[model samples]
Target chain A: MEFCATWTCPGPDGPIHEHAAAFDRGRERRVLIVPALFEEQNRTRRLLVETMRRLDAAGLDSFLPDLPGCNESPQDFAHQSLHAWRRAMADATAQFAATQVLAVRGGALVFPAHLPGHVLEPVKGASLLRHLLRARVISGREAGEQLTIEGLLDQGREHGLILAGYRFNPAMIAGLEGALPAHEGQRTILLSELGGGAALWTRAEPGEDAAQAAALARIVAA
Target chain B: MSALASDDTDDRLRAILRDVLGLNADTVASFDADTALFGAIPELDSMAVAGLLTEIEDRFGIVIDDDDIDGEVLETYGNLLAFTAARLG
Candidate 1:
């Protein structure tokens, strides 16, 4: 079952309340799930939720927290930064008392180092930005916007640019472009189709792969 | 015909193709140098290309500079394998 919870963290404006969903097993072993960013998050949310259920079944508690300006959070995306998100993840870890982390894609950029966990498909910020730019360019062309990704990126640097319905500030873009996946723990899981059906995040719409969730649950439990 | 890679490099490239493209084992097993990749396979889109490059770099311990990416490098299964094998050398 999904239990909604919130974590308050200091932000540039004031206190930001970040929402999280806790998959409760009433047990002590807990895992915090840091999700992929932007559209990727929407695409993989179902798999993450399913994995949380599997974790609950395996007698493990899991928490999926939304960073500022994401999910149910009302914070402005324009004000969000990698630094603030890193802090948010840390706060969630302490608030939920999580002992392990399960991060996917760009989430690895902000993963807490002290906790032992699995990181799947860890990506660099520059690589992520490139992909995001490609997507925006393609969509822009389809919409007849006559916008180039280079132009958009330059505009973002000058002020902010809205990509795929999400507004990105210059600071956030710079922070994300410089961020790289960080994990000191030995347990790292690369992308595979063994437990997952495919890379659902590449799909155009929200997708789910139960096998992927099962694979993730098994790894985290192990 | 082009130069052939060692059985090991060929095997690893095949596995990488299967894993990154999410292809079935049978499909990957039958694939050869002549097999078209980027444009032929619908799943090998721009986004999938990023995932493929990241996976290749991770599994093969290679660093694919942005300049290394081009139409010729990703043209076929053979082209990708040779690029990777050359990197390994």
Candidate 2:
């Protein structure tokens, strides 16, 4: 598979540029990956690369774009919003015929409002965090020290902090906070301690089972 | 009993917050149980809010049902702490 260098996408403001790669095979699924936010993007980079490679070997052509304002892209930090980022991904997805657009981590939340043939992957953003927390714990980290979503409010406690990249604005945060996942912790959550954070949400666990089968089991068996 | 609970809760909360927001220990040291969050810090967005909840559930071994609360509860630092304590207790 021949991977191209960086490229640009058409945008209303200007060209939404990114570190672009493209590979062609015998008419396989065309996929686009919306990367995670802030530093999570860095930690998950290797897993993502491997995922793209797997897709390539599976004969699926895919596009992984460094959204504007991130990595080697053109959008400035302050100007990057969920809406604009969604648009950039939308533009890339439209280029595909019947290819699937899959998003990982926080990027999952940025899926287009009308997701046609979009594979959410494992789950959504909130569950990704939950899975990540577990992955880190099970891999061996201090069980007592992981951070969480509701715990972030800190009403009784003030002046807590953590290091992060990306300028996360309120509108974006509000939208994110509103989403609640069907499930949180998984096998990775328990073993996450030894593994740090990356081993969770993004780490590929191979198990084939039909989602519809599980749901129907509840209804049909019941 | 009061002092022990206070110390433990404060320490636990500080560590949790520090890790969640990517804040340094010193920054959390300056925080009490009553600081404003949400608009106060640019990083505390809805996405972070949701991520924070997942972390809390995993670390504290608590189950925060999808229907337990809404995003507004996470809009401030103090509110979040109270919510956690309530659930933990």
Candidate 3:
């Protein structure tokens, strides 16, 4: 329903509890939703949550957990990396006893690959990084500051750079540059398959499509 | 590289615009070569341009150089389509 539940993940120092939105009715089919990363997370939360609602209506239970540094979590976003997120998700899977996963957008990069489920519009970590860098470049241009993707990436790798208001550490930058979504044992669901005009993640603001959500739930529930 | 049809590029570009800008089907279908983008559409702000470029690259399977992009390239629907068609060719 809401953040009425918490899942324990191994933190850098010790085990940490993170807020999770769950639709649990003790259904036989439980889906762990790995939401889109970064700004895309905000852009697609409603769509994912709507989809979860439909899944629940279809007699499926689902859990949408926050990444350690995201949402209501007390962790610092800058200190997070792909490795840490993957571990956190893996722990989420175990703790929730999720039978299937629903990795959306960049979440594909960190979803537990060992489980069979669905990946919606999976994107490479490099692409995600490029999108962020390009946004920074565009904003820089508008502000009369010349910034190149290559230059920003170099700086990010050496130290850390704030892209689109997100402070990323060197490890996070490096990890994102090479992270690719795992495909084995997962069904790739493209936007086309969902019969949607465009993915919510691409929009400048967050929006939702009820038809798209229903289509996704039907696919997952089927 | 094999060339892509001009009509195909036009359709794909329109689709990208519709998806990226969240334009309705009628609005996208009504887009002509002279249809202004960027400043004309409020949704096509600087942030959206980033996503638009990345989606164009992904759909068209061509890498876009940052130096090659400018206001001129995104001035109109025609200009963007022509540029993508040129890259495909």
In order, what fnat does every candidate score?
0.04, 0.00, 0.59
Q: What ranking of all candidate models by lDDT puts the best one first?
A: 3, 1, 2
- lDDT per residue for candidate 2 within A92-208, as digits (tens), equals 667544255555546655654354333223244444434433333322212344444345423112432222434445444444445532222211112122233222232122112
Greater DockQ among 1 and 3 belongs to 3
After superposition, the stretches of candidate 3 with alpha carbons farther than 4 Å from their true spots are A1-3, A12-14, B1-8, B26-36
| Model 2, runs deviating above 4 Å | A5-7, A10-13, A96-98, A113-163, A179-198, A201-222, B1-56, B63-89
Local distance difference test, per candidate? Answer: 0.78, 0.52, 0.88
DockQ measured for candidate 3: 0.55
Instruction: Estimate how well candidate 1 is docked, as a DockQ score.
Output: 0.10
Residue pairs clashing in model 1 are A195-A211, A195-A212, A196-A212
Models sorted by DockQ, best on top: 3, 1, 2
Poorest lDDT segment (10 consecutive residues) of candidate 1 chain A: A134-143
Estimate the TM-score of every prediction: 0.71, 0.48, 0.89
lDDT of 1: 0.78
Report the C-alpha displacement of residue A104, candidate 2, in angstroms.
1.4
Query: Which residue pairs clash within candidate 3?
Result: none
